[model samples]
Target: MRTALTIAGSDSGGGAGIQADLKSFASVGVHGTSAITCVTAQNTRSVDSIFPIPVAEIRKQLRAVLGDFDVRAAKTGMLFSAEIVRTVAKELRGTSFPLVVDPVMVATVGARLEQDDFADALGDHLLGLAALATPNRFEAERLSGIRIDDVESMEAAARAILRLGPKAVLVKGGHTKGVLVDVLYDGRRMRRLRGRRYPKTLHGAGCTLAASTAAYLALGRPLLAAVESARRKVAAGFRQSYRAGHGVEIIDSHAVPD
Candidate 1:
């Protein structure tokens, strides 16, 4: 079976982070491997605390997986610090497989996930190595310094982010008011992917999208097709989402039909 890896934190709630990534990978029929960067005490409602795994031990996990498995593609989620971000970047440098970078900044419950200086490290070391970078509206605004009020500004932000060296950028418009639209740009052209706005706020939607894309890439699909497939998968997952806790609904990507 083809394999994919997720370099991310472990969410005890099983709603997001490594748990979500692995579930998304399995849904797409890809073997999921992971190198946990941190462990978080979080649930649907809040993130109480986070403990970063030692950089040396994190490297060992990466080496073990990379050395033993034919990892066809990979995605990164919550790297809690600048050092961990740089470490992951260094490990993935020059790798042949596609990488989907989910620039995770804040949790679904409005808690900050990354360190204050993490953004600089991510932009400098990691974004350049991505095959695709998936950032939501707020993250796009932070990364591109452009406020995305409409499709035009979304495209502008994608363009600005593309200049940071990712092969493609998907500026997710999930935070917008009406019907959802995600602007995808691959430098040559821009495509607007539209999806319905579900009533419930689902946790881990972004992680699922990026992870599914990585799994599809591991399955040898092209970048555009993989992204489209991933989006559809997440949409379906949201439809079937259930409350795993008293707070937000968990996006059950595994509940979707393969």
Candidate 2:
């Protein structure tokens, strides 16, 4: 079976981060491995606190996994500090693995997940190594310094981010006003993926999307095909979402069809 790795934080709520990534990987027929970068005291409602793991420990975990497992692809979520980002980049260097970076800067409930300095490290070291980078509206604004108000601006932001060296960029439009439209730019072609705006917000949708994409890549699917499949999986999970807390629903990764 194919194997994929998630280098991310742990969500106590089991709705995002490593928990969601593992579930998404399993849903897509990939064996999941993980290197927890931090632990968040959070639920569907809010992130109360986050405790970042030491760089040494994070390095050890990455080394252990990359050394043993035949990891075909990997994804990064919440690297909480510049130190962690640099450490992860160092460890991942020289490997030919396809990386899916979900620039997880903030929680769904508006909690900050990383230090401001980490942004620079992410752009400088991590993004250049990524095969694909998935950033939401807010994250794209932060990463590209482009305020996205419409599809045109979103396209500009995707182009700006693509310049940072990621082979492809998916500017997620979930936070947009009306119909959701995710823009994908691979420096050559651009595609817009539109979906109905669900009445209820769902937690872990981004995590599930990125992880499922990594799983597909691990199975040897091409970039665009993997992203398309992952988007469908996320939509299915959204349809199967349930109210796990008082704030928002939680996507059910297990509900994604085979």
Candidate 3:
């Protein structure tokens, strides 16, 4: 079986982070491997606490996974600190496989997930090596210094982020009003993808999309096709979403294609 790796934190809630990534990978029929960068005590309602794994231990996990698995593609979710981001960037620097960087800044429950310097570290060391970087409206604003009020500014944000060195940038429109529009831009052209407007935001939806994209990439799909496929998978998951707690609903990672 083809294999993919998720370099992210472990969520005890099983709704996001490494748990969600692994589930998304398996849902798409890829063998999912992971290197946990931190552990969070979180649930549907909130993230109560987080414990960062030592950089040395995180490095060991990455080495162990890369040494054993013919990891076809990889995606990073939550590197909670600048140090962790730098370490992860360094570890994947020269790998041949495609990498997806999910610039996770805050949790679904409004908890801050990154250190103050985390964004700088990611922009400097990691994004340049990414096949694609998936950032939501808020994340795009933070990364590009452009407020995305509409599709035009959204494209501008994608362009600004593309300049950060990723092969491509996907600026998600989930946080915007009306129909969901995600813009994908490489240096050449821009492709705007429109999706259904779900009533509420699902937890881990971003992680699932990024992970599914990596799964498709691992399965040898090209960039745009992989992203489109991943978005479809996420929408399907959302249609079948359910609440595990009283807080927010999570995507049905279990309700996946065989």
Candidate 4:
């Protein structure tokens, strides 16, 4: 069986991070492995606290998995510090496997996930190494220094991020007022993935999408196809979403495929 890896934080709530990534990978029929970078005391309402795992330990986990498993593709989320980001990038430097980098800067409950120096570290080391970089509206804005109020700005932000050296960038527009449109720009062309706006607020949608993309890539799908499949999976996940806590609903990573 094909395998994919998620190098991310562990969400104690099981709504996002490594937990969500593994579930999403399973939903798409890929065996999932993980290298956790941090652990969080969190739930649907808020992130209570976070403890970043040591960089050396994180590298050890990566080495263990890469040495033993035929991991075809990998995605990263919530590398809480500059050191962690640099370490992950260094580990993945020469691997030919597809890498999806989810620049997870903030949580759904508005908690900051990365340190002040994280942006520089990620740009200098990680983004260029990624096959694809998935960042939400706020994250895109933070990375590109462009306000994304509409599709035009989204495009601008995507182009700006593309300049940072990723082969492609997906700027998620779920936070927009009306329809949801995610912009995908590979160095040459751009595609807009349009989806309906669901009434419920859901957590883990980003992690699910990125993880599913990695799963598809592991399955040997091309870059664009992997992204499209992942988008559909996330939409299905949203339709199957359920309230896991009083604060907000969580997307069902195991949503039946359509």
Candidate 5:
């Protein structure tokens, strides 16, 4: 089986972050490995607390997996600080495989994942290193300084983010109403990925999307094809979502192909 690694935080709630990344990798038929950077005391309702493991331990976890496994691809979730980001970026630089970085700034509940100051470094240092950077409307607005209210605005956001130097940028449109349209911009082209919007959110949709993209890239899909494949898979995951908690349904096993 192919191996993929998820370097992310663990959510006891099992909805988003590392839990979601593992489920996504498994659902996609890739053997999943993980490196936990932080642990959160979260339930379906909300995040109550978080414990950050030492950066040394985080590096150890990363070293253990990347050292042994022929890791095909990797995805990163919440690093939560500039030092941790720098550590992860430094370690990943030597790998031949593709890396997908999800700039997880805020949680679903509006909690800040990183301090305000680290936001700039995250964009400057980490994003430019990624094969792909997945950002939501808010994150795009923050990273790209572009507010997206329409398709044109979304394209502008994608372009601005691309300038930060990721090979590509996928701007998720969950923050937009009417339809769940995502805008992906590579230096060569601009494409809008559209899915019929799901009114209720299934937990970990973005994480699932990003993880699936990494898995697909590992399987040799092109960047656009990777995003397209993952986007479709994530859409079905949302459609098949089930109650993992009282608050929201999770993408769960739906990351698997039909």
Candidate 6:
């Protein structure tokens, strides 16, 4: 079996972040490994406190995993500050690997998780280096500077983000109303992936999508194939979403496909 790595923060809530990523990877038949960037004292309701790991430790965990594991692909989520983003970019240099940058910024509990400059750094230094970028509506708006209010707006946002250099951009419309219609753009063409609107906003949906894409990439799918498979997996996860926390239904990573 192929192996994948998730470089992200840890959610003590077990609803998102590294926990969700690893579960999704396993569901897709990939061995999952992780290097945590932040640890939050959180539960189903809200985050109590956040403790960020040192940059040196984060780098060490990444290198140690890379040295020992033949990671077929890697996904990054929730690198919460400018320094960590720069550090992660520096560490990924010269590695011919498929990278998925989730560009996580906001928490479900209304706390901001990324620095104000992270989107700029991501566009300038990190995105071009990624095989793909998976940003939902709010994150897409932050990344592309194009506010997405509808399906047509999602297409425009994906195109704008593609200009930042990821070979493919999957702009998730999971945040929109009427339907969950995700848009994919590659500068030359566009594809719309639509699904029924699940009634709830599950925690960690973004992390699950990004990590599932990594799993598909690790399994040797091409970029578009990876995006497609990730979308299907997330949709099924939504259908199987459960009430784990207080506010929204949390995605059952057990919804992971085999």
Better of 4 and 6 by TM-score: 4
TM-score of each: 0.98, 0.98, 0.98, 0.98, 0.96, 0.95
- Model 4 misplaced regions, further than 4 Å: none
The whole-model lDDT of each prediction reads 0.93, 0.93, 0.93, 0.93, 0.84, 0.87
The model with the greater TM-score, 1 or 5, is 1
Checking candidate 2 for backbone clashes, the offending pairs are: none
Clashing pairs for predicted structure model 6, backbone only: none
Per-residue lDDT for 1-258 in model 3, tens only? 999999998989898898999999998789999999989999999999999999999999999999999999999999988899989989998899999999999998999999999999989999999999999999999999998899999999999999999999999998899778999999899989998989987888999999999999999999999999998888888889998998899888655642
Model 6, position 141: C-alpha lDDT score: 93
Backbone clashes in each candidate structure, one number apiece? Answer: 0, 0, 0, 0, 0, 0
List where candidate 2 sits over 4 angstroms from the true fold.
none
Better of 2 and 5 by TM-score: 2
Q: What are the per-residue Cα lDDT tens digits for candidate 4 across 56-134?
A: 9999999999999999999999998899999999999899899999999999889999999999889899999999999
CA shift at 142, candidate 6, in angstroms? 1.2
Looking at model 4, residue 149 earns an lDDT score of: 89
Question: Could you give me the TM-score of model 3 versus the true structure?
Answer: 0.98
lDDT head-to-head 4 vs 6, winner = 4
| Candidate 5 per-residue lDDT over residues 113-215, each given as its tens digit | 7766667877767777788999998888998887779888989988988888788889999988776788888888898788888888666888888999988
Candidate 3: stretches off by over 4 Å = none
